[model samples]
Target chain A: MTTVTQEAGAPFGAAPPPADGAGESAIVTEGLTKRFRGGQVAVNALDLAVPRGSVFGFLGPNGSGKTTTIRMLLGLVTPTAGTHSVLGLPATQALPRVGALVEGPAFYPYLSGTANLLRFDAADPTAPRTTARRRVAEALERVGLSAAAGKRYRNYSLGMRQRLAIAAALLGPRELLILDEPTNGLDPQGTREVRALVKEIAADGTTVFVSSHLLAEVEQMCTHAAIMRTGTLVAQGTIASLSGGLATRVRIETPDTADAARVLGTFGLADVRSEAGQVTAELGGHAPERINAALVEEGVAVRGLAVLRPSLEDVFVGLTGEGFDVDG
Target chain B: MSTVDTSTSPGAGSGVRAGEARRTPGLVPVAETLETTERHARPETPTPPVPSARERWAFWRLLGSELGLTFRRPRNLAMLAVIACVPVIIGVTLRIVGGQGGMGGIIADVAGNSLMLTFFALSFLVLLMMPVAVTVVAGDSVAGEAGAGTLRYLLAAPAGRTRLLLVKYLNAAIYAYAVTAVVALSALLTGLVLFPAGPVTLLSGTTITMAEGLLRILIAVGYVGAGMAALAAIGLALSTFTEVSIGAIAGTIVLVIVCQVLRAIPELDSITPYLLPTWFTNFDAVLRAPVDFGALREGLVAFGAYIALFGSIAWARFSGKDITS
Candidate 1:
């Protein structure tokens, strides 16, 4: 079952599979946990697995421990319990194979972007100058900020700074790329550019473990996702599978809204509402096509019949019970 | 499909081998197949690069970066310029005042008069000006990153806290040394250009040759450097406690000023040489004939102790700090 799930359709990109099974799993954690001084758990008993070459989106509300999880993966913060591995090596032992940009990408503001890359290259002994420069140039071009390479970071706009951070992540030729809120301050166009770059990288056989609060971005980019609330993983699965189990909403524009609601009420679907000559019902465990046929045969004038598939946000709300102010 | 061999290649199969080997000769395929099988049998993975001794020297790299930042500013250059002009101004004033008193006599007078002037000028520098410069260079070394929200990024790079603090301290030391060198060189050149190059009379009524006087001046500069180093370390130690650079600068200057005021009392004069700023005027004693190496030696030891004491505190605090805040 695990092997079948791992071999599912490659959503981002397809490269040759790991020849020696080296890339079978880029990141794996078992019962990982962290707690602050006040005994408040920031990350709790997380059991996660990210297959090689997959774009895994870690989604959570603000303060839901996404950053904490990324930090632990990068070995910046030690876990309170359990163990994790990256690129087939233990997380504590695989520092070089992992490249990350956690929080805002902090760099020496006085240094040019090229100079900053040089410093990171210097820090990584395995990364030779020639290779690092080639990677840096390629990454800058990939992010569409090659023109600003010579400029100091202090003069860079927020989006440009974010790109520089991404460029830093790409410097190590790392097997797994971890980014925390990489698109935090970007405009829509900038967000799209980063989204495209992430897809491009993942397609090239690098595992990208991204933690973000943007549900829409996660839905568009991630094939596999995990949702966390207050430090606990509430749901984890493939997007298709998670969405498939959610109840689909059905909206009917009927001449007799009251009569339609009365008929739909017999099906025991929860929270049926009526307004403006329209009846909307949350149908549970029933196909939208079957529900529509039933509504029409009941003699209701169906002016409009539309099925609302549950979005990632709806699944998150349904699982957590509390509606998240997603925009906030 | 020819039965797919699910074997790992020896030496982690060449990145392009799997794609390129398809068209290769028969023997090559046999050998490649064997190599792939060997690679899959090994369970232990390759180890990543660990932070070796050489990599740990990022502390020095950080120090160099800090120095670059310090001199990059035009205001720092202006401060250096002011320090360099002090001796020239004193020489010119003495030359103008003692006309026809013979250039040799004017040189002697200027040398004597300049001591008080140097003391007053350097007092302001030591108590407030120099500390401000040291603070500006060292105080922001780590805390500034925290303020700008760059600390986590730097720390996340796994930069060790001890290495970071050491780099900051070294940068502060460089600023102190440079500031002292400028003041000392300016004083020497101004005295040489404005006053006649000859023997200088000391307060002890003994005359010393120009070479001897210059030698004594060099020793005085060393004392200045040591004194400033102590101030820089103290400022750096204070820097680790706060993210605001201005507060560190202000705190250091305030501490120096309070020490200076307290040391000025006649009763406190006995213990003043033990204080960091007390030795700022130790150069005056060096100017006396039969040079008083006693105070200079005491001042050097006192300054060294301060450096070790304050530097260790900075290192200890930073190494264990919970930098996420």
Candidate 2:
């Protein structure tokens, strides 16, 4: 993944024009900016268009303004400049139909999971109290927390706490769900469960906007992703479009590494490197068969050749000029 | 040329299938995973549904939830229990001493009648104990939620900022009344069991019927409760300034102490009436016949002024504040 670091150029950082236009975007921000009182810009002029019905992943390394951006999108923090809309309405006005778990799961530590959900549900004026109890129970069960529904939040394991936060967000049918670092403290099994739950929710056509630093999580769960670094968007688009924009690399293992590198350099491939009896280069719009034929004609024995598509991690690092932590 | 790929990106569906398999061991069977999916897919109206009867009353529901949380907290309940015990301790100790040794003034008055002990305890607690108890509830209202990181959830629940602030203030106000009632009831009970019950002696040296004396104590409780509620408003305002509950709690207590300290200075007489604690003990006006409406009204107005001023401060600070916590 780190083998290539091509400059993404002007096409990056520019807003991804949604295929169906602004009407289909669940969230739209126009130069949204947030500058703290200490003169630090946490989020700077972000123009995001989260397509409707897409599992949009706001991927960034730690402290890259992921939480701050989520907070501003949810109206927990007001932006210093520009405007943003959620679910086709102003952020605050559309909040009733939006369910969010910001930063982490937070509830009355003394109250049971069931009671905490009841209180959160009560706070939503649009949520009918008539069905609150049943809804709360269903939410808990959906997150597989029924066994621990009566457990005090303070006594819960970290995974249980994370699940309960998800339960709270699912209390009502939300048109938009904004979750920041949803799987932060969960165990590996719990993390997989949450990823599945996110997919299930997104499959139902609810636009899910999830922010995380985990590249694997985003790669697996998201249909589209926006990469952030130092408060500005590095790149964003459909998962296929993001990776498709990068060049496919050609790797050949042979004893004539120097000859293979020389032949590949003559073919004008990018970043051709020879190491340990192997040679690799970005085959940008080049025929792999032609490259192999040229290598063989030049007496460079091509023992084996493989073409590799750059992963999302590679795409992000290329755009941001920084390696994102791939581990959970 | 054939392509050989080593790394395979996991499909989204495989994870869901694995999740489904693992979910079979969940305590409760997951039934609505598909049901809710269909529910969300249905093309619904663009506008929000008109609220049902139950939803219309959600304000009161949230208030009830807030009150339940406030009263149910072990810390707040412990403070209340301690407040109740102070009056009882004062009554039992007074009874043991039996008005011997010229303890004088309120002590001698309390020895004369059981009802006077209620007034004596109110005077003793209104200055410090009651303020501390009220501050604990009100001071922690917003700051505690922020400290625990629940404030963001509540705000995102779209608990309108103004509405949330109102609920916090009302919760504190209700708790203040609870504290006052606890003190008065405990004192009244202990005094009746230990001291003589009869017509009460007034500060004016006039004796009134036991029924009238109880009425005066009831009025005094209201007066003190109102004062504490006003103090709670100040606590709520301070609560909005920080994420740490202890900071707000201590800030409120320090303000009250500063007011009391200023009130004690003879040269600061001009500013004494403006201090919240200064009017706290003005419930003594209820002891006079026909109820000294002038003094009582002045104290009520002061309390009202404090509530109005600080309540606005809290609303202004809270509504525009960013919830980073």
Candidate 3:
């Protein structure tokens, strides 16, 4: 549960780059840019390299181009400029092995889930009838929605609808699954289920690219992450690596909080707070053991000592100068 | 994370766990959860696989699917049924009014001139009914999907917007053709069933048999279908502009009416053939004894031009559209 935000000036300390191979990256982009008719750039110079079989989390604030990037990656919205590839296939050439549920689950309201899947199955030349049916059933079951398989999409709850969207993405056994805010409307339990599902899928070797504002979930589920602000990628790396350079807080509870604070201040720990026999201070390059030793020498009766590691939110704010909505 | 041992119960394995075991490891858990909650997974009972895209788009399959969706709706079905009974209703009313005299003769006289009759019957349809039909079908082609937030899913399926638009247009055309045929057939049957079934004097002082009259009616129906194609194209173009089906429908209807009014001006009479509604009544020349194909030919060119123009606009709009919202 250690969380640390690596500062930009800090040396690069990411996992060793994946071995170069022949298979296409799940999603690759170079100089990707999108500008509206008015010349307002939505996504600017996005050069992303999502390795195959990794759960890549795209983090951004509202209108920060996360959805725009996802749209371009899926070819739903053509990029204003640049190139992208999904499932090792050039996005412009053809997108056969890519399945995405961008924005929301959109299905024919009048058609039953089975009918909708059937229509989609019929739309793809590679999916045979028997295989499509089996896949549809399998997908339905995977989203914990077999019981509501026959229900009209109009009648489905928001969470159920989100699940259906995921189920649709699951169809055809796609090589890459791109989901944007997949757990948008899900309750806590539902969110956990989806998080676990994403992890399982990634573990199984399918490149899963997801975008969300849920920092906690991203911290838990993503092996690699990209953070965006004002239509630019400000940070990209593993969670642990991103958090490594953030300030660490040490909270100490002692018989005499005032004395502990005074002792820490003498050591140049100017930012110290003492309340109710407890003291907390920012520890700069100092270990908990060092602080404990100092307190013991000062005859301070320490009852408890804990280090508070920076979470993803803190790291994100540090990099972007703005905090993302955790609930999003 | 809780070690409650929930897996021991018979139903414990009935949800995501049971389903996940069968799928590829990458997608197992998702498949499992969906299977366990089948009730919420989809809106229909799972069925056997469907034909591939190529097979589904095979001529007959596309046609059948298009026809099924068109006529399945009660409104469309009723329109067809009403059109079929038009001739019978006209005949019955004529008979009740006694022999061809007074009000009956007036009705007969109007119906006697096949061109005038075609115009009279379709004026109501073109002014409102046909627009409504075009709106009902083409307006919703893309806009409805967008409104329902399904456009993203459809696009993600990698469905080319061109193909989707083509399918929707073709579907609307089929319904339009069916509607036209029903109306024409009903008029012919009613005219035969009610009026004197024999050679009739034409406005041009030529004579024609009932068989010729029926042929003329068919031609009129074809013209109406062509006119509807323009309406469908307009609808499609509007559909691409906005996600509001009602807006597309209303906009197309108003545009059609405006075009019709413009075509009526004496100064613009030469350009009338290019207008969808103007050519709609050009079915008149078909009633001549020797068959006057001049207006019909011009009307065809006009219809084709309208289709090309409006169809191109729709294609361009949809191709560049950002459907992510």
The candidate that wins on lDDT is 2
* Number of the candidate with higher lDDT, 2 or 3: 2
For candidate 3, write residues A1-328 as lDDT tens digits. 0112223332111221232222446677889999988898999999888877788889887788999898888667778988876654456323435678787677767667776766665554344454667889998999888999999777888888888888888887566788898888789988998998898888777788889887887888998888888789888877777888687888999979888998888777747988887898988787789889999999999999999899888988888777676643
lDDT string, candidate 1, B1-325, tens digits: 1213432333334424743676554545766666555654444454432321223334455555456667875667777777667656665766676655656543446645433334334434555566666666666666676676556555544444565566667777888889877766666666555545677667677888767776776676677777888888888888888778677777878888888788878888777766777766676677677888887787888888999998988887776554553
State which candidate has the highest DockQ. 2
Q: List candidate 2 segments past 4 Å from native.
A: A1-22, A258-273, A283-304, A325-328, B1-54, B99-104
Candidate 2 residue lDDT tens string, A253-295:
9999989988999989999988998999998989999999998
After superposing candidate 1 on the true structure, give the runs of residues whose Cα lies further than 4 Å from its correct spot: A1-52, A68-97, A105-112, A115-136, A152-154, A248-253, A256-300, B1-40, B43-60, B87-91, B94-124, B200-209, B267-274, B283-294
User: Candidates' lDDT values, in order?
Assistant: 0.71, 0.85, 0.71
**lDDT tens digits, residues B160-268, model 2?**
7888899899999999999999999999998898889998889988899999999999999999999999999999999999999999999999999999999889999
TM-score head-to-head 2 vs 3, winner = 2
Residue A122 in model 2: shift from native, Å? Answer: 1.5
lDDT of 2: 0.85
